[model samples]
Structure formats: C-alpha cells, structure tokens
Target: MNAELLARFHGVIPAGGVGTRLWPLSRAAAPKFLHDLTGSGSTLIRATYERLIPLAGGNIMVVTGRAHRTAVIAQLPEVSDLDLVLEPEPKDSAAAIGLAAAILYRRNPETIMGSFAADQVIRPVEVFQEAVLEAIHTAATGKIVTIGIRPTLPSTAFGYIRAGERLDISGAPTARDVVEFVEKPDGDTARRYLADGGYLWNAGMFVAPVSLMLKHLERSEPELYAGLTEIAAAWETPARDETMDRIWPNLPKTAIDYAVAEPAAAAGDVAVIPGVFDWDDVGDFAAIGRLNPASEETGVTVIGDVKRVYSDNATGVVVTDSKRVIALIGIHDVVVVDTPDALLVTTKEHAQSVKNTVDTLKKNGVMDVL
Candidate 1:
C-alpha cells in the first residue's frame, strides 16, 4: 500500500453491467469486463483491483450480480468470497454502491473511500497515481471530489460536468466546485459546451469520506438509505448478512451520481478536477481502435483466416466466418464486429448506435447471441 494515501480509504468497483451495448462480444454470460482488449494481461475486474492497489489495502470490494460471480471469482483468485458483495439480481450502480458503502460503514464508519467504474482505462501510472493523490487531498474536506477528464471533443455520448471557479482549500493545489452536472447532450449542445470551456467528461470516479456520501444519500434517497443504514448497523451482528439479503433486493437501482453527487452538487459540496492522466472508460469495441497510439495505425480483427482481409481499415474489425465474409475493400473508420450468431458493420460515426441495435434485437427476440 502507498503509505501516503494510507489504509483509511478503500475501493468499490461496480462490475455488474450486462454490457448490452457491446452485444456480439459482450453477452450475458460473458461480459465485456472479462474481455482481454484492455491489455492488462488480466480481465478488466482484475485490472481494476490492481489499479487501486496503491491506495487500498485488505478492504477492496467488488459488487456484482450473482450471474457473474463465478467469472469474477475465476478472474480474481486472490479475492476472497466475502470481499465480493453479490447481488441476487442486477441492481443498477446506485444500489451496488450503497451495498458496498453499507459493508464498509459497518466495518469502519470514519473511513474515506474511492469508487471506480471497472471499464475505464488509465495510462501512465505516475499521472494516474497522482490524480488519486490529488483526489485524496481534496477528500480531506467533507465534500465529494470527482476526477474529471479534460475534454478532447464535444462528445454527445458522455455526460458533462460544469465546474465552477476554483474553490479555495487550505492545502489542496487546484480544485473547482461543480457549477452543474449535465447528462449526455446533443451534438450542437456538446459543441457549445466544449467551446465554452467549463465542462468536463464525467469520469464517474469519486473520492469522499464514506460517511459524507452515506449522510447525503440518506437525505436524498431516504427509504433506500434506511435499508443501507440498517445493514451497516448489523454488519458484525448475526443479522448483518440477513439484513443485506433482504434489503438489497428492494433497493432502488440507480447510479451514485444520480442518487448522491447530483444532489450533493445542488447543496454545493461537489468539486471537480481535470485528472492527471489520459483517461478512457473503454466503453465499447470502437475504443479498441481509439486506445492505440495515434501515430500507429493499429487494428483488431477476429475469426477471419485471410491475411488479405480487413486491409485499408484505419481502426479494427472483428470478422466471424459464419456471416457474409467482411471483405473491407477500402473502408476507413469502421469496426466490423461479428459473432457466429450476430454481425455488426458500423462506421465510427455510428459506433454509439450499436447499443440501440442490441435493444432492437432484444425486442425482436433475437437474443440468441445478444
């Protein structure tokens, strides 16, 4: 553990997503977090654990649906059964996080914490480590601190954080209050947001004292908060697991941002910072293309045996032999992903629409592959 950050803060990773957006590759049984494209030589969940090793010790927790328990355990052999907070069904991120908070608060009420979205990628260990340090420093106060990504584009697909003028802190170097939090905006509004220069891509990372989050969440979502509170109170008692088992199923599914930060921002206790490293959530297949260094024209191809296929492609393509042979004659900025059961041929512009196609497939009962 990094002695500087101390063992007071723990980490919570939400890995319960079904990843319907990346259907062909990320199905119900095999989720995207297990995908090897992130290149950490381990699954995304494992990589997430390793990433937080510097700040957390002996208290790392993973909250995931029971469906993925076997895979999560297989991927993280070092993590014990109790380290994972298994959900009976898929509750959205909010419930998952509350459950983690419940567990941690029961053990230690005064600890500070960090929450991570397992799918993201952070490069340059020094910069990423420094960002955590910065967040930790900001968290010393009662406010919730979020590491914001400096905008590279007016991305309509990502949420925006409107950071206000820098808030004066005694020791913290640079941190700004959240002026507003905006969900995914349209193309034009996104462009305006980028040009305006106060917005940041919400990185979905938070550094705050666990007590502060729980207090605020209790006020914002009272019933759910009561359930979590009861669970926290019973943690070491005989009814601890029983309380969680009963309450987790009834907890409302939400994101920490919606149930916690958005409300905290309204109360004027949120802060934002352009993180210290190049950051990415690595949300889908197209990201595989974007993650590679801009100087190198790297590509990812799948299942096709021909050396000549998928040439002239700027990004990558996944070719499954069962479908029409994806012979890319002269295509640029396209990711041709295929499984034996499903195929997706999309240009970069339409990459974000892949999830819509998956929704349509689900509606049509074509979930054989999805």
Candidate 2:
C-alpha cells in the first residue's frame, strides 16, 4: 500500500437513500444499506466503509440523513463527529456529495475527494484499488474523474459513459477523456451501446480535487453551491444546526449526474478511468438474486437463517429478518421477504415494481409498515 498516495486522498460516502425497491426487508426506518443483504455478516454501509479504509484511512466522511445518523454512527464507530456530514433532509446526491466537497474545501482546498455510494458491491478488491489510485492521480491534475465500469452486457439498468481520446498520464495509463454520459437506454439503444466499443456503465464513483468540484458546482449550480458554502462555513460553529435547518430543505433536489457530470463532460473537463472489476448497485430483488443466486440443490437463495427456510421445487429468493419459518413449495421465480411488520411477495419479473408497493401503502395511509 502506498501510504503517501493514500494520505493525499479523502473518501466521501453518501448514504441517504431509502431503497424503496427492496421493501419489507429494506424499510423507511432501516434502508438497504443498513441491512446485510449479501449474507456476509456485515451491513452494506459497513462493507463500504471497510472498502475505503485502506485508501483514505481516517480521512473519510459519510453524509447521511439525520434520521439514520445514529445507525450510521453505530455501524461506523471509527468515524468522528467532524467526519459525519449529516443532512437534515434528503436533497439527493448533489446536495449530499456537494456538501461533503464544500466542507472538505473549507478544511483543505487541495484535498482530493472521492465519492462512493453506500449501497454498492464490488469484487476483486485489488482491481478496485488500482482503479481508484489511477482516478486519484487523474483528479489531482484539475480534471473531474469518474470510474466507468466495463459493460458485460447491454444492461439497461445503468447509465453509460462514452470514452474519447486516451490521456497519456504516467500513473493513470488507462485514463481517457469522457465523451458524454447517456441515461439508461431502451433494449435496442442498450444493444447499440454494447455494439459500440467506446461505452462503459456509469458506476457513480467520482474523484476530484475539492477545489475543482466546488468550482464546477459554483458554475453549474450557483444557488446550491452558495447554500452549501454557507453551511460549510458554519459546519463547526454553533450556527451549524440553525444554518442547515433553515437552508437545506429549500435547496434543489438534483443528482450529481445532471447537476455536474453531464455539464462537465460537455465542456470536456470530465475524465473516465475504466474499471474492470465486477460491480453491482443492488438496486432491486433481481439484482440480489443475480449477486447471490439460488442454491443448485435447494433452488432457493436464502439471505438469513438458512435452517429456518425449507424449500422444495421452489426457485427464487427468500429473505427473513424475523424468527418465522419460511416454507416455499412448487413456487418458481417468486420473491418472499418477511419482516416483523410486513411481507413482500412478488415475482422476480415484477421486482422492479416493488417501489410501487411502497407508494400503495402510502396511499392507503399505512405508515406503520413503512
């Protein structure tokens, strides 16, 4: 491990999403990142923290909602009060990451910050480290860098990043200029992207100098930049609560992709470092099924207490957060999730619509389960 390189980098983790798609198990009170979805005996947020410790050491900040602040702290005790950038409300990724960047800018203008989501799963740890190191080196040169995942298929679930001419940076041999970021495409468009060799999946992993990130934010989102700068100025002062509560909710709810990356790419200021490691956003049940498939013998992917589950001729996923015994018979491609307050039963094909279930519960005034 290069201690000097790691010393120059700081990690910013944004963990505010409710993850409505993985409902019943992932609730409003406890989102997916708080749960150990991988059955790896560690929560997603914890795993994310572990992934960055080697690179950023103690120079890491986690931006999360005020509601989940206690849980985030409980999960990551190593993080200090100063490193926990709490948001009074969810203002999307732009506000979350931008707040971290602005706060770090005030602390040290030259600090290199990398933002990684709190709910992603990446394999081949060595490869991830290599990609991040290259991204860090590229970001230090005043370029906003994003790690672009090599596409395995024409996956419509993720956004694609097109690569332009390659850069001749010494440490970052695979670094390339970003052409444009394309939103999730349809089946045909996705296939076309696959046919073209220049496209990569946008993994949402961004690295850049704090000053560069703030400069772009100030140019593209002036109001948000101003509000975040004010909050950062008062971040350590007694005025923190007053400043955050008064100005946070009223800020625009936009993602960093639209708020910064897209515009920056158009101006030829963004760079992409191709990441060859396996990655998953774990967006829905189908993703969970893909990551941890059903056992060949039992034909069931059980998340918790395998002994508590009994399956025969059943092929799908089963997630339990309680002591209840789950039994499935003659069911195929079905998803059963059991929690104390609610149970979600849906087909693997309809897993993407699980968010609508949350909407329905809200419409019916069923806040207790949510």
Candidate 3:
C-alpha cells in the first residue's frame, strides 16, 4: 500500500439499525452492532473501526443515531467527538453516508471516502484491507467504487452485483465496470445467478472521492444534498448542533445503493473490486449459529455461559443473558434467546420470520419489551 494513497483515505461507518430479525438480543436501545454476536470478544462496531484504522488511521468518521451516542462512544473511545456524526432520527443510509461524504468533501476535496456498515462480520482482515485498497485506488480515478463480495452460496438474503469487462486501472488490477445492481432474487433466480458466475453479492460497501459521492447525491437527490450541504457547512462551527437538529429529521430516507450506486452504474461511472474475504451480515439466529463454534459434546452453539446451557441430542444456537439455566432435549435446529425481560424460541429455518414478531408487538402496543 502506498503511504501517500493511504493518507488520502477516510473511512465512514454507518451504524444504525435495530436488526429486528435478531430481536430480543438486538434492541432499539442497544442494537446488534453493540453486541459480540460472533463471540469474537470485540463488538461489531469496534471490530469495524479496527479494520479501517490500518488504512485510514485517525481519518475515520462514524454516522449513527442519537440514541446510541453514549454506547457508541463507550465502545469506540478512540473516535473523537468531531468524528462522530449523530442523526436525530434514523434517515437510513443515504442521509447517514451522504452527510459524511459532504463533510469530508468540505474538509478536503481530494479525500477518498469508504463507507462500511458497522454490523457485519468479515474475516482474514488482510484480504478485506487489500480489497479496500484496490477500491480506494479505483475511486481516485473519479469513479464510484463498491467492494462486491464473491458469493459463496445462492443466498436470496443479499442483493447481487453484475460485473462487466475488467478495467485497466494503474493500481487496481482487479477492478471491473459494474453492469447493474440487482435486488434480492427468488430462490430459483439466485441459483441461476450462482450458476452464471458473473454475479457478486452486493455487500453495500462503497469507496469514492468525497466530491464524486456528493455529485451523485446532488444529481439524484437534490433536496437531500442541499440539506446535507447546509449541515456540512456548519459542521465545524458552533452552529453544528443547531443545523443538524433543524434539518436532519426532514431529510429523505433511502439506502446509498438506491441513492447513488445504481444511478452511477447506469451512467457508466461505477466500478467494483472483488472481495474474496469471508463476509457475513449475521442477519438472524441461523447466521449466529453458523458464525459461532458448536460444543463438541452438545452440538449446541452458545453465546453466553456455556455451562448454563445443557443440551442432549439437539443442535441449535442459544443465547442467555440471565443466570437461569436452559436445557434442551430431543430438539433440532432450534434458536433460544433468553433475555431478562423476554425469551425468544424459534427454529433456525424460521429465523428470518422473527421480524414478523417484532411487527406484531408494535401493533399490539407492547413497547416495554421492544
């Protein structure tokens, strides 16, 4: 990696989202990003910050909800106050990431920014860093770059990116033109995409010049761009809080993919760098089971006190926050999460449907547990 190139890079982490699918463990007060879902000792957000520090050094910013301000600061004490961008309300990724880009652009127009989510698990840090370096090198050419993960399975859970002809960039040998961003397809379509071999999972990771990011935002979403611009202007001044409070709630809500990536790809301005590293969003309990190591004797993956969880002829994931002992017998593929106020019991096959339970609780006016 070039020292000069690394000096020009800035990393932005978007850390909002309650992760309803992993409910009971992931709550609005403390989302999945704050927890050690992978049993990796470090929380997801902290790990994400560590992963970027090698490339961006102290030039990193975290964009998250105001509700999580204290917790985020506690987990990432290295993040300076000025580097933490807090939104009064969740306006999705577009506002969160675009605001960071606008502020970086204002600070230094030549800055290359990379946006990585806070609640993802990526392994072999060196591989991920290498791919990000390529992304940065490609972004320096004035094109919006996205790091697309090589799909390991026909997973319908994630969006897909179509890679076109390979590009001939000076420092980015594996860079390629992105044909299009495809939404999550049906099972059959996902399998077909896997067989076709031209598709990569859209990991929502992006690298681009701050100026180019803002240019796309200005063209695709003028109103949002204007609001972010006004806020960025006052970001370094005493009026930062005043401007953010006044304009943040009204900004349009959308993901960076729809707001920037897709449009840029259509305009022939988007490129992709293949990420060969292992990546997981940890969407539900099944993912949690997959990520954690199972006990040899019990065949049960435990996130809490392993001794407290007893199992016989069972295989599943168990997470216990309380001291109460949990025992399972003659069960298969189960997911049991025992929190202080709530207990969730479901099968791994239906793990994705846990969001439906959260919806039902909201409809029933059950806000205490939520």
Candidate 4:
C-alpha cells in the first residue's frame, strides 16, 4: 500500500440515509448500515471502516444523524468523539459531506478527504485499494476524483459517468477526465451505454482536496456553503450545538451529485478512476439475493440462521432474526422478511416497491409495524 499517499488523505463516511427498500431488516430507528445484511459478522459501517483503515489509518470521520450517533459510535468503537460529526438532522449528502469537509479544512487546509457511503458493499479488497490509491493521486492534482465502477451489465440502477480523456498522473495510470455525469437511464439507454463502452457506473465514492470540494460548493451552492462554514467555525467550540441549530435546518437538502459533481464536471474539474471490485449497494432483496452465495443453488437466500429456515420446492429469499421457524413450500420468486414486530411477504419482482408499503403503513397510521 502507498503509506505516504494514504497518510496524506482522510476518510469520511456519510451515514445518514435510511435504506427504505430493505425495510423490516432496515428501519428508521436502526438503518441498514448498522446491520450486517450480508451476515458478514460486522455491520456495513464497520466493514466500510475496515476497508479504508489500512490506507486512512486513524484519520477517519463519520457524519451521521443525532438519533443514530450513539449507535454509530457503539458500532465503531475505535472512532474517537472528535472524529465523529453528528448532524442534528438529515440534510442529504451535500450537507453531510460538506460539513465533514469544512471541519477537515479547519483542521488543516491541505487535508485530502474521500467520502464513501456507509451502506455500500465492495469486494476483493486489493483491487478496491488500488482504485482508491489511484483516486487519491488524481484528487491530489486539484480535481474532484470519483471512483467509477466498470459496468459489468446493463443495469439501470446506477448513474453513469462518461469518461473523456486520460490524465497524466503518476501511480494513477488509469485515471481519466470525467466528461459528464448521467442520471440512471432506461433499459435501452443502459444497454447502449454498456455496448458503447465509454460510461462507468458512478459509485458515489469521491476523493478530493478539502479546498477543491469547498470551492466547488461555494460556486455551485453558495447558501449551503455558507451554512457549512458557519457550523464548521463553531464545531469544536461551546457554540456548536447552538450554531448548528440555527443554521443546519435551513441548509439546502441537496445531494452532492446535483450540488457539486455535475457542475464541477461541466466546468472541467472532475476525474474518474475505474474500479474493478465486486460492488453492491444492497438496495433491495433482489440485490441481497444476488449477493448471497447460498442463493446460487436454488435461487433461495437466507440472511439469518439457516437451521431455522426450511423450504420445500421453494425458490426465493427468506430473512429472519426471530426465533420462530420460517417454512416455505412451493413458493417461487418470493421474498419473506420476518421480524419480531412485523412480517413482510412479497415477490422478488416487487422488491423495489417495498418502500411504497412503508409509505402506505405510515399513511394508515400503522406505526407499530413501521
């Protein structure tokens, strides 16, 4: 690993989003990032931290909601209080990452920060590390660098990054200029992107100098930049809580992509390093089914204890943490999620609409299940 290059960068994890699609398994009180959806023996956040700990060392920061602050700390006990930036409310990625970047800038203007989400799943550590190292090198050249996953399939679930020209940066031979950022496309557009071979899936992992990111925000999102700077000024002082209360909620709830990346790319300031690691955001049961190795045999996946789950001519995904046995018979392409307080039964094709179920429950005042 590039020890010196790694030492020059800090890791920032934005951990606020509630994975609504993975509902039942992921809830508002305890989001998906705090749970081991893969049964990997560690939570997603912990896995994310361990993935970067080698390169970032102890200079890692987690920005999360006030409600989840304690759980985040509990899950990541190695993280010090000073490195944890607690958001009083959910203000999306722009505010969350901007707050972290502003604070890192205050600590040292030269600090290089890379922001990764808390819920992503990446495999083959060596390949991921190589990509990150290249991304850091490219970011050091004063451009916003994003790690782009090579498109393995014509999947419309992710945004595409159109790469322009190759960059001449040492130790980052694969670095290329980002032509533009494309939103998630229709199936035909996605298929064309795959066939054309110029687009990379925007993995949402960004590496940039604190100054460059803040400068972009200042130009593209002046109001949010002002609020972030204000909160950052009082971050380590007694006025932190009061200052945050006054400025945070009023900050624009925009994503980093819309606020900084798209504009920066249009202004010729974004680069991408192609990552070949196996990655999955674990967005839904269908995604989880694909990730689980056990599902390969009969297209059936189980998240909890396999001993407690039995199936006869069944083919789908079953997840449960409850002690009660879950049995499925002659069911195909179904999703069964059993929780202590709620049970969700749906087909794999409709897994993406599970969040709609949560919405309906909320509208019906069925707070007990939600």
Candidate 5:
C-alpha cells in the first residue's frame, strides 16, 4: 500500500449498541465493547483502535452515545475531543456514519473513510489490514466499497453479500462487483448460499470517499442527509451542541446497509473485497466461550479471577466480577455470569435468547440490573 494513499484514509469506529444478549456482564451502563471479553487484557474498543492504528495512524474517530462519553474517553485517551462524536440518542448507523462522513467531507472531500464496528473481534491484524488496503484502493476508484468476510459457515445471524465478478482495479486483486445485499436467510437458504460459493457474510464494514458517501446518502435519503449536513456544519463551531440537540432527534434511524449500501449496489456503485481473516462479533456468552481459551482441566472458560470459579464435570463459560466463589457441577455448555447486582445462568445453546431475558426484565420494570 502506498504511504500517500494510506495517509488519506481515516478510520471511523461506531461504538454503540447495549449488547443485551451479553447481559449481567454487558449492561447499558457498561456495554460489552467496554469489557475485556477476550481475556486479552484490552477492551473490545481499545483493541479495535489498536488494530487500526497501523493503517489509519492517528486519523481515527469514535462515534458513541452521550452516556458513554466519559468512559470512552477514559478507555481511549489518545482520541481527541474533536474526533470523539457523541450522539444524544441512538439514531442507528445511517445517522451515526452519515454524520461522520458529512463532517469529514467538510474537512476534506478526498478523505477515504472506513467504518469498523467497535465491538467485533478480528484476529491476525495483518490480514485484516491487507483487506482494508484493497478496500481503500477499490474505493479510490469512485465506488463505495465494503470488506465482506469470506463465509466460514451458513450463519443465519449475519446478512449475505453476493459477489458478481472480479474487478481489474489496480492494487486490488480480489475486488469483486457486489451483485446484491441479502437479508438474513432461513436455515435452508443459508445452506444453499454456503454451497453457492459466491456469497460472503456482510460484516457491515464500509470504505468510501467522504464525498461519494454523502452523495449516495443525499440521493437515497435526502432528509437524513440534510439534517446531518446541518449538524456537521456546526460540529467544529460553538453551536455544535445546540445544533446536535435540535436536529439529531429528527434524523431518520436506519442502518448504513439499508440507507446506503443496498441502494448503491442496486445502482451498480458498490464493490466488495473478500476479507479472509478470523472475525467474531462476540454476540453472546457462547461467543465469549469461543473467543477465550477454555481451562484444560475442567473444560470451561473463565473471565476475571479463575481461582474464584470451580467446576466439576462442567464445560462452559464463567464470568465473575464479585468476590463470591462460583461453583458448577455436572453442567455442560453452561454460562454463568456473576455481577454485583445480577446473575445469569444459561446454556450455550440458548445464549442467543438471552436478549429476551433482558426484554422481560425491562417489561417488569427491573431497572436496577439493566
């Protein structure tokens, strides 16, 4: 990758989402991104920033919620106040990403910005950076590009991207034209897609020129573009807070896929670079078990102090935040999370349904735990 090309690239980290499925340990006050779920001694967001530093250098921005501003700052002290974008309320990815694009466009129209989620776990940072380099190269050719993960399995949890044909763009050998963006398919459809060999998991990672990004947003969603433009114009001024407070609430809420990528693909303005790297979103306790190394003796994964947790004939994940000793007996694939105010016990098979428990707690007005 050319140093000049890399210098023009800016990284955007969208660090939102409460991660309800990872409850007890992952709460509204402190989401999963703020926790060291992988036992790598670094929080997810911090790891994400470090992963991008080699490619993006100091040109990185973090978009998070207002409530997490202090914590985000505490975690990423290198992020300047100007680079930290705080949303008053959740308005989905379109607003978050579009606002970032709009603001960067005002500063430099030639900017090639890549948006990577703050919560995903990607390994072999060098491979990920190579794919990003190709995506950035492809994006420089006046097309919106996304780094699509090569599907390892027929996963219904993520959307699929259909690759059409290889592109002859310079410096991007694996670049392909995106045929279409498909929603999460049923089990049968997902299996068929896996067998098709032309599908990739839509990882929601986008790389595009700031100008082109805003152009598509303006065409697909004019109202959202207009509102974001207003806020971006005042972002570096004294009226930034007032402008965001007044206009942000009215911006439409939609993911970047629906608001930009899907429409851009339909218009034949989208391309994809297949990323052959290990990636996991860490969606639930099951994912936590997958990411962390299990104890060899007990066949269990433990976060925090391992000495405080004891298991006999158990195979699962245990997360402890309190001093209380946790003991498990004869349980297979169980998930035990012990927090100061809440405790969650479930099996790995039912980990995805943990979000339902959070919903029920909210419905019953169990606000303290959430």
Candidate 6:
C-alpha cells in the first residue's frame, strides 16, 4: 500500500488454500502458503504479510481453516489467537471473505481492508502500492475494487478481467471500469483476449471498505450475510462457538468470483485498476522456479541451485531432499525436485504439470508423502 493510502486501511490475508499442487513437501496439514517455497528468508504467507506491514500494523487478519491452523500458528510468529479468523470448516472465498468482513466490522466498523492472496509475488514495492492505492480510491467511491495486471502471456491458469473506461484518481494508477470477468480461458481465447487489448490477468488482489463488502453480501448473498452475521452476533456472549458451528458448515463452497464478485460485476458495481507491477502468482513449482538466483556463466536468473549445477543450465532451478548431493552431470532445460518420499524431474516447460504427480500419489494412497 502507498504511504498516503496506508493512512486508512487494514490488510486481509486469505491463507486457506489446501495447496494440493505443491505436494510431497506441502501436506494437507501444512499448505503451500505456509511453506518456504521461495527459498527466501520467509514463507509465502509471511513474506506477503510482511510486505503489508507498512500499511497495517499488528492489525493484520489471516483467515484459515482448522486443518492448517497448527501450521499457521507454527509458521507465522506475528499472528495471535485474536488475529486469526478461524473458520470452523473449509468454506471457499465467499465464506472466508464474509467472515473477514464481520470480524473486521466488530473491531472497526468502517475499516478499509485490502485483500491479499498470500501466494503471489510482486516486485518493486512502489508498483504494488500504486495498484493498491488505485483500488482503494475506487473502493472509496463505493465500487468493489480488484487489481488487473497486463497479461504477459496467454495463460489459461488465471482468470481474466476485461478493462474498460479509465477513471481519474490522483496518486493512483490507471483505474478502469471492469467490463466483464472471463474465467480461465483456453490458450486460443487467452491469446485473443491479450492481443485484442482491454484484457488483464485477474490478480485476485482486492480492496473494499468493510461496510461496503458487508453491504455487497447483504445485497447479493443474503443467506451468507445473515449466517455470518449470526456468527458475529454470537461473539457477544455465550453463543459464539455454537453459532459458527451451525452456520459455517452450510456456507457454499464457492469462490468469491462465484459468490459475490460475479454478481457485483453483473450489476456493474466492480472496477479493475491497472496493476503495472511485476507480479506473478506462484501457483506451482515452475512458477516458484522463476524466482531463483542468477547464474554464474550468463547471469541468467534461476531458482533451486542444487539442480542447476547438475544440468549446467544458466537459468536452472533444481531441488532435492537427498541427504546426499544432487548433481546434474549434463542436462539442460530440466527441473529436478526431490523429497524424502518422492522425486520429480521434468523439462522446465512441463514443470507446472508436475502437479499431476500429486494426484497420482493420492490415488495410490500414499498419504505420508502428501
């Protein structure tokens, strides 16, 4: 967040994904957000939160489920019992966000909360802040705001936001009216969307006034609104835990796009702001591999040093859980990942598909590996 924008906003981290993609190392108990996938000094969740500390002090909120609670508690030292919005069950984005709004409302009714994925990487702090400031300004005008990054490639993995007319917001980047949200498009469609202009990669980063989000829920998802409202009201006295048990179990297992965003977009209450920041949602290993250090020969940036030396590739990322060394005698364009229970070796182009290994392992009933 920008310094000026920092004056009146709180940060919200939705750190509740099951992280099935990064299996073997990332388990059901310890999700991807809690793992040190970056090889940097911090976990994805922690680093993401640290980036927001300039804007929000100790008031950050992490919404999580029970399965990963222990790991979240173990991983995030800055977190306290009160700082978490622990959902009783694994409700999707809609419920998780609804829960965050209710809790933030209890603390500060008019708080402006910025939503974070806790699994993305955006460089140059200035760009991230500019994007957020623009979104906040849009939110201030009663529009639910989400940042849209200019797509570098036609990626089918991420959703798309069709950007439209620009708005004037001082100290903010280009703010555009979102025309429509197109869910993950196929390669051909994605390429057309990118080439056709007015399309952006949905960053999943959002900003909204707590009251505005609550109002959106009230307008679009009244049952969820009432259910979480009941949960919040129960916090007043002896009925707190009881109410969560009743309502949280029934929350629709739907993403925010399905729950609230799509409805708001249908009603033309959503806006997309240009996020010219260097951003990447490190959804899988290949994405994480891109963040590796530079090579000695060509100064080519690479991740996972252990395998790079073996393959002799300038921009190589190699990881191994072998107590012994992992050497790439003569290999190129290969990714080698090793864990105590499993090993993965693939070409960089196919690294993202490595998630299929996880699914096969699950089908094989190898619970310990996952």
TM-score of each: 0.88, 0.97, 0.99, 0.96, 0.99, 0.89
How much does candidate 3 score in TM-score? 0.99
Error of 4 at 215 (Å): 0.4
Cα lDDT of candidate 4 equals 0.90
Point out the worst 10-residue segment of candidate 2 by lDDT: 1-10
Cα deviation of 132, candidate 1, in Å: 1.1
**In candidate 4, what are the lDDT values of residues 286-331, reduced to their tens digit?**
8888877654545578888644777788888888868888888898
C-alpha RMSD values across all candidates:
3.2, 1.4, 0.9, 1.6, 0.9, 2.9
Instruction: Give per-residue lDDT, candidate 3, residue 315.
Output: 95
- Cα lDDT of candidate 6 equals 0.75
lDDT of each: 0.75, 0.90, 0.93, 0.90, 0.94, 0.75
The lowest-lDDT stretch of 10 consecutive residues in candidate 6 is 299-308
Better model by TM-score: candidate 1 vs candidate 6 = 6
Name the candidate, 1 or 5, with the larger lDDT value: 5
Clashing pairs in 1: 94-254
Output the TM-score of candidate 2.
0.97
Residue 41, model 4: Cα distance from true site in angstroms: 0.6
Ten residues in a row with the worst lDDT in model 5? 304-313
Model 5 misplaced regions, further than 4 Å: none
Candidate 3 lDDT, 1-370, residue by residue in tens: 7788788899999999999999998999989999999887899999999999989989899999999999999999989888999999999899999999999988889999999999999999999999999998899888999999898899999999999999999889999999999999999999999999899999999999999888889999999999999999999999999999999988898888889999999999999999999999999999998899899989999996544999989999999888899999999999999999999999999999999999999999998888
